[model samples]
Target: MKQGAQGSAATGAGDVPGSAVRVPPQSRGAADADVDVDVEVGRERYDAPGGVRGEHTHSETPLPRPRPAVQRASVRGQIVDALRTALVAGELRPGEVYSAPALGDRFGVSATPVREAMQQLALEGAVEVVPNRGFRVVERGRRELAELAEVRSLIEIPVMLRLARTVPAERWAELRPLVEASVRAAASGCRATYAEADRAFHRAVLALSGNEQLVQVAEDLHRRAQWPLVGGPGLRGRAELVADAAEHTALLDALVARDLDVVRALVGEHFRGAR
Candidate 1:
């Protein structure tokens, strides 16, 4: 994987590159090294409030490497991404009490890393951390989700339309695989993988829009609003997945033709479908 302006390329045999805010590779603690490892486990699980599972596999092999000393940013990144995913997926319901220690246990790490992660999440509006008490997942009402989707439409759709025009042809070559791969993953019922790939595709489009700040804001908003729709338990059924795949293809065709009106309408319809 090639590194992009916003994040590093995924390195290592089993490692997958993740967004700066939402990615963490699976690895075990130093003490559990000798066990018979069938499932390659992520160091943390971002379970939604009702136990919504994200991208994972049973037969995947663990990466063979020594655990590096924990870094604060990395731990915080994992926590933020996990909690954000949970919030979007409606797993960690609003007002739910969460213990830093329990989170630490769940991720197969120590309390310090979990605490660090929670603090970052609180700053992002995904959770609230009291000084003496632990953290709580912030509840977003359905109305809030609707309003958020509206706001995202206002911001993202035009940019996506503009990107189809302004971005150089060479960059389109770079982006094609991201969209096609996402469609393939979604078609195959790997929702988690599809979600990840879809995010990369959109982010790649945002990158082409030539506005870094807008891209950042869009990502923050997306983490809270859009992710849950696909990441949540409600995501299933081959028909729905096929529809999503078709949407991606339609968007691609519009981009290729530089049909701003068509792509804009497609973007609007795509998000409205989520509602």
Candidate 2:
């Protein structure tokens, strides 16, 4: 994460020369910082219905903060993550081709990492490589999603059950960050954040098996299941997302307790609701 003078990049509709704007993690350019930027911060004044204007100033309104940019090889993973969230939210349409160079430019990074990320997406079956053109999103359907869920269940559940029985409670406790991320994302109704956090949680859960391939396959299936939800973010309301986020907490509970019956039930419910 890049740390410096944090501002909201409030570049009005061509109103200001250098106003703060959120960049994807570390995608901010020196050009953006070139102009004299004024970020309205700190004090907040609210006028009441029947009172004088600027009468009350209690606390500052929470403005959207700038997202940090990542580094080096991590940028590839970040790009993949950004693309996945965009895919889930239907920002990238099916059957339409997007070039690696263009996407790299869009992300303010090099084509190499963007291409590498696209290759990973291709492995996940989220996109297909189109010869000289680029990658196109695979049209995901209900049948495809169900099959992905079934495969994930077959691969992930048995190993997860074994880990629940064998792994120590402290190990499960280590996953609190991932769980908390999902909780925050769900509460904020941010699909991109929730999806990435959900990915991290499931991948962390499967990593206990100590099988790299197992974790990879489970993550791939997880991504596939999420991409085609037509109105995915809209459909998953705060309430539904909160309930979904609770599952991670509940799963952790069962794992720590070593409750085989509850673990098994939760595992089943996870896949069921995932579809």
lDDT of every model, 2 decimals: 0.64, 0.73
Model 1, residue 17: C-alpha shift (Å): 42
Which residue ranges in model 1 land beyond 4 Å of their true spot?
Answer: 1-70, 85-91, 130-133, 168-170, 188-191, 227-232, 235-241
* Clash totals for all candidate models: 5, 7
Clashing pairs in 1: 26-42, 48-91, 49-91, 49-92, 88-228
lDDT of 2 by residue, 1-275 (tens): 21124444433222322343222222235653323222322223231222223211234343554443455568888998789878877688777899999998899998889899999989878899999999998876667767777788788788888998899999999998889989998898766677778889999988888899988878767877777554333555667778889998999999999998898888778777773
lDDT for position 182 in model 2: 90
| Candidate 2 segments exceeding 4 Å error | 1-78, 100-105, 109-119, 130-133, 230-233
Q: How many Å off is the CA of 145 in candidate 2? A: 1.2
- The worst-scoring run of ten residues by lDDT in candidate 1 lies at 32-41
Question: What TM-score does candidate 2 get on C-alpha atoms?
Answer: 0.64
Assess the local accuracy of residue 198 in candidate 2 as a C-alpha lDDT between 0 and 100. 85
